[model samples]
Target: MKRSNRLVALTNYFLENPRLHKQLPYFVNRLETTKASVSEDMDIIDAVFRNEGLGYLQRTTGAGGGVKYIPEYLHEKSEAFIHEMCHQLADPVRILPGGYLYMSDLLGNPKTVREIGRVFASAFSQMEIDVVVTVATKGIPLAYSVASFLDVPVVIVRRDPKVTEGSSVSINYVSGSSRKIQTMVLPKRSLEEGANVCIIDDFMKAGGTITGMINLLEEFNAQVKAIGVLAEADDEEEERVVENYTSLIKISNVDLKAKSIEVHPGNFVEIGDRK
Candidate 1:
């Protein structure tokens, strides 16, 4: 490959797989390029990315820290990339008999999960998302992944009380799917008044849990910067509550008999408008 093409590929690779970029010496040696040359190419790529309104790329200094890409790029290509992954996750074969899809693989896959997190973090790139919030269990990992990209702290909402934590403020919320009354608790010090909060979750059914989370934020007098979900099940009944939220993938249907699934892009097509 030509030098220019190689640089572009390297930069794009780093953007997609940041953890790999951190081991720069290894990559540099493998590519048979000097560290200085790689550094110069990275500078050029970073400039091009930012100039094109794609987003900014950052490199951290020191032994442990390394090059990282903070994507500001909101484009058709990125959206399509996320949409494709959502479709893959929507496979009907993955859907168990209970109409619930097995998404643990997608959620645990580091590359896929990180990409999904970056997609949402990009949406809040401009906003001051002081902290990321999510309910206990499944949402915790998603919340942590997004928080890592945003370089912000994560505040987990507990579904049940735990003995290790100190005093916590609790709220009663109805589950969107079950419509059963459930309690969510957060440490009083987890967030502060007037904090710019971003809420993230793995799935959304009724959005009642999100509503309760929003209420919890209100109790702290924090402003919800935005709400994002990895995947949303297109259930007509649960649609009412989550009408205002944004989802990366909209799973419209799962034809178990045919082993087919339907998916679509979310309303985030115009993420740049938020600026």
Candidate 2:
């Protein structure tokens, strides 16, 4: 293969699977080129990535370190990829009784979760998103996956206060569906003033929990660049508060009697230009 094509292939490989970049030898073995040639190609790829404003290609120099690409590449390809996945998640059969949709399997599957995380991270790639925030315990994995892609930190919002979190600020917000009051708390110093935060969650029933997160972000004087949910329960009434947020899938309804479910992509993908 030509040197230029090799570089592109190498960079794409790293973008597709970041963990492999941690082992230099493994990444090197994948190529039929010399170590010196590989190093030079990586440098060229990194420059191309930066020049294009796609983000940065990070290289850690250590015994176990390898090369990884932090996607700065904003392209139509990325949007198409995300939209296709969103459509898959729109299956009605995935829904359960009581207006609930099953997403634990998707969350536990690293490939799916990583793709979902990348889609969100790419959306906020240009923003100064210092942290990825989510409420426990289902949202933790999504948060972590996004943080990894964004190369940022993940902060957890605990339902119950813990001594480890030190002093926390708590708030009570109305549930979007249940209409019952639910509480969400965050550590007082978890975020800095003027920090940009991207909130992620596994699912949305009433959007009450997300609103609570918004309120918490406000308390710290932080800015919410965007909100992402794995799936949203579709009820025109309950979805009012979440009109501004983004979701991978929308569950229109779950009819237990008929054993029918409905799902579709949210507005985020349709409107996201990511320019």
Candidate 3:
């Protein structure tokens, strides 16, 4: 095949099987071309991927050498998208009676959620994540979105035990905002032993829910690789339960009486800057 055709096919293959490594000889044989010609095609494809902020194509040397496609969303693009979300979240009309900003609209948007997933996936891409874990309801979409990009399955924790899920483990945790104890249930067989889990959530006040999920994972002997949230409520009085977590947007301040809300980029801004 022609070099142009080879480049297109190679690009598609990388996208279809991201985070996969393939030896140069495999490509050369598949394309029925010399190693030098295949290398030339890889160069063009790699350049396009990096220049377009698509991802990274890493080349390894030595006896067990190969090329790996690592998906990455450029920090600049992620920052811009997140800042735009902040503006949307800053709308005073979204402020509810309990100072909760209405985010159902944002969470329901497939396009928005997909982008947020990409941001989370990019943020935690360095980790060896095997499964995405989240609570039922609001967090399901976010969890699925991140899992899709990472090519992993999602494990959802439920408020009430379901008969359909079979045997399950339950744990009680304090609700940061409500200041009440609540039980969360997870299926016993949902996760495997030593599985690297990435926790994703929609909003966090004191991180009580995420904390509960962490405790529940203990039963399955899974490791928490990373944590990510779409937004985090900045409440000074309420101490955050989880220390190492990333959020896309920060709710700095909210006033129901004044109908005022303040939002800005979250910890990801600092993290993304370093990258």
Candidate that scores best on lDDT: 3
Give one digit per residue, the lDDT tens place, for model 2 in 18-104. 433465566467777677788888888778777865556678886776677777535455556556765666566666656676677
Clashes of 1: 2
Q: What is the C-alpha RMSD of each candidate to the true structure, in Å?
A: 6.9, 6.7, 2.0
- Writing each residue's lDDT as its tens digit, candidate 3 over 122-149 gives 8888898999999989999999989877
Q: Of the pair 2 and 3, which is ahead by TM-score? A: 3
- What clash pairs does model 1 have? 54-73, 55-72
lDDT of 1 by residue, 1-275 (tens): 44676686787686665332465686576567777777787788888878865666678778875676676545655677776886677556687764677888878788777777777777777686899999888888778777876778899999886778778899998887887999999887678888899999887777888999998888899888889987777777546575557677777667767677776765665544353
Best by TM-score: 3
Task: Flag the better candidate by lDDT, 2 or 3.
Answer: 3
TM-score for all models, in order of appearance: 0.74, 0.73, 0.91
* Backbone clash count, each prediction separately: 2, 2, 0
Cα lDDT listed for each candidate: 0.76, 0.76, 0.89
Error of 1 at 196 (Å): 0.6
Kindly report which residue stretches of model 2 are placed more than 4 angstroms away from their true locations once superposed.
1-40, 43-69, 72-93, 273-275
Question: How do the candidates rank by TM-score, highest first?
Answer: 3, 1, 2
